[model samples]
Target: MAKVKINQPFTLLDTRVGVAERQTVQLEVAKLYTHTPMTIPIEVVNGAESGPVLMVCAAIHGDELNGVEVVRQLLSKVDAATLRGTLIAVPIVNIFGFIHKSRYLPDRRDLNRCFPGSEQGSLGARMAHMFFDLVVKKSNHSIDLHTGAIHRSNLPQIRGDLSCEMTKEMAMAFGTPVAIDARLRNGSLRSEASGLDIPVITYEAGEALRFDALAIAAGLQGVENVMRHLKMLRGRRRKQVHDAVIAAATSWVRADVDGIVRAQVTLGERVSKGQILAYIDSPLGQSEEAIIAPRSGIVIGQQMLPLVNEGDAVFHIAYFAHANSIVEQQLETFIDDIGPIS
Candidate 1:
């Protein structure tokens, strides 16, 4: 086994937290026009024993708050004194978007797409560089928490490049019933992390700027499960997890007409080809339309709001070859396994 120096101070961003110590380190991202500096808050828990370093981070989009809560709850359950490795929990990654309750930086740029950025780049790029340089480079593995964009809710699932053995292990260990074998977007954080050979998995659930207890519970449990798998913490599995699918194909069902929609199915429901997924009713006329599933798959994502424009995406479905009645029951039980919020 590879060994990391133990019983010593863990220095990050020039701040030192000793082994068996849990400390919060604040990283400065930028300075406001008022000469005030923006900062990203980080919690570092270096274990007494030597093991792989894992970073669980959330809220890269700023509006994705479910992950924020997940990281908070995860920190509460971990004790640094007994931890075998190191954990760096960053609940808020996009400080600009988070403070403004937006998914974009002040410049309206997607912070997620700017990675390993330059110091003299755009605000988004600079911020991404700061986090990657300070947090990501030091970690052996990571989990990037996320939620569906505004007006959409996602069934709890894991998304990443499952072709990588390490990534595949993390996704399976997450206990989510569905997993998307997502491609790495250009300049994305996951892409940048993968470039450095660090494996990362993204957990998507709930909606932006909102808190769903089920998503948070699933996220927390999933993180704990991953830690246990990595031997960073000793714990019992939260539930009997089943195998997850590397979705063979996935696509979004777009609106056929501009109108208000009434979704016919809920997230996580299985659908057959040509099945109606939602109904759109125009406010001014009788131009009602039925949105049908283009292929047989599970409804992994859907718009929460009724308002829509023609061609707008309404449903995200993923096709799995082995999905059947048995898989459907597993999804139902998985939701219940996460437990209640209060």
Candidate 2:
């Protein structure tokens, strides 16, 4: 282990053991209806020196595993003895969804939409409230990691409200090649956190229920970059760290005809208006349809499943300042900067 310099002790989530130590603390969220206890696992790394409290959390959707790996690799890179401030990691926030290999709890509630929950709310809501009170409220800044829905893949990107100076700083530091100005949803963790003036951003990459090695690598690097920007770590500045292109306009192109589709572009590919992004062919060899881009932009997310119904979302495009060329040229360089997965 690299030597960490000792300085000061920091308190987090009510656990005050000492500085320069990594502690795994469990917060019992609620009792399972089956007479068992469910706990949210938290990893705290409080540095010896004083700095900002940055929380890196993942698995809010249960099946999203890229963030899990990111958190794991992140912890492996930190040495609390010489570190500054605290890093609170909750690698798996939705244990019920993870336990069942599902994206929701047994009650079919999406935990991400139940923030600032009430103590007497539904099972998911109660869990959300407990986490908000104990974990989120304690964070000075946060990175909420996520992946695309089932059968969908997203290019590594940071999505958040970029109008704020602090929030935009973290997004730019992520170096994802794409920074989306995402709207806040009611009852969401980001919404609740922003209400309290904490700069929280969403890092979206890969897909659910599986691990994309490149996504994991990029996520780890992005999180570290944000920490470095926050002065939580001291090291040589990362190269090409200011490559994120801000995209405030984004739209999804839906499949106009139900059929087996063959995509002409993959995630991260730029497309022009009226470009044939994909072709849909009927199984009976009767007819064909072309899924064209409604406007010029880059493909930030795409469906992996070939089978699609009419009106189903097939491609998600993000419109940058120069979506047609500037962003396109920077995309490959951005990937190379992050390097291949180890």
Candidate 3:
């Protein structure tokens, strides 16, 4: 087990504070190979009374930069002195990956797939174990931020097991328009946290290594919505009620031919069966194959690269025919709230 020592006069719970004092919690979680300390940086803004502990994390996948920026902006504006309980922000957990601009550990392990990790395992596993123990296990709620994989772009969306009441409540509280009732994959953070009964949600948006302004805005608003739901911050009742539909299923539409792809639809566009989505054309445009949607639904994700292989995934659409009305209304509000992309 990892050793821990809490500073005295600093109670872990029911911490009381006034408007003049903002409490900050700092600690060293471990030491890196470079002999430098790996600081598990935490800022606690305890309110005068009791409330919930919400953790906002970023960069589990080091290539995802929008979440990192969102956390940075969140810290800048929050007046901790007037806040409640705690808001633990881990801006960069995968430090090694962040520095290398890679998605996995030096040992080639994907941290996201190594959750509830072993303390006596690889570097990634140890870090995962440490993070889950020190950060996730102690919080009332958690948000794991991410972006689309390296060559893909995602519409800002919250993915979680909506079956759990707490998870569903928080997902709705997260104001993102495209809330996907994503199933929990084994070894994923959501799965482990669910096992431990910790309510956690994952927000994915934009594309890896790039920052989209709409993604940032949607993220910020989503966090605020969660805080509002938890009573951590007081705000106006959201004008639009969250209307996330549970997608019965989802699938990626793959390319049928190899060529330069010209996409016609965007991230949030709705398409009917057989609607043209993209056209794979030869280098000289002499031969072209039109890729069409196989089913009717909204495009939650898509490939950003124009180049395509014979079976490359080009689009990910979620099927929710019954809930299209609510989904459409919520999407409009989300688009309006995020405003035009910067």
Q: Model 2: per-residue lDDT, tens digit, 136-216? A: 988899999999999999998898878778999999988888889898999889999999999999999999999999899
Best by TM-score: 1
Better of 2 and 3 by lDDT: 2
**Candidate 3 worst ten-residue window by lDDT:** 4-13
- For residue 249, model 2's alpha carbon misses the true position, in angstroms, by 0.3
Candidate 1 lDDT tens digits, 256-294? 788999889988888999998988997875778999888
Tell me each candidate's TM-score.
Answer: 0.96, 0.96, 0.89
Runs in model 2 with CA error above 4 Å?
Answer: 1-8
Off by over 4 Å in 1: 1-7
TM-score ranking from best to worst?
1, 2, 3
lDDT of 3: 0.79
Better of 1 and 3 by lDDT: 1
The residue ranges of model 3 lying beyond 4 angstroms of the native Cα positions read 1-34, 38-40, 237-241, 323-326, 339-342
> Which candidate leads in lDDT?
1
Clashes of each: 0, 5, 0
- Against the reference, the lDDT scores of all candidates come to 0.89, 0.88, 0.79
Q: Is candidate 2 or candidate 3 better by TM-score?
A: 2
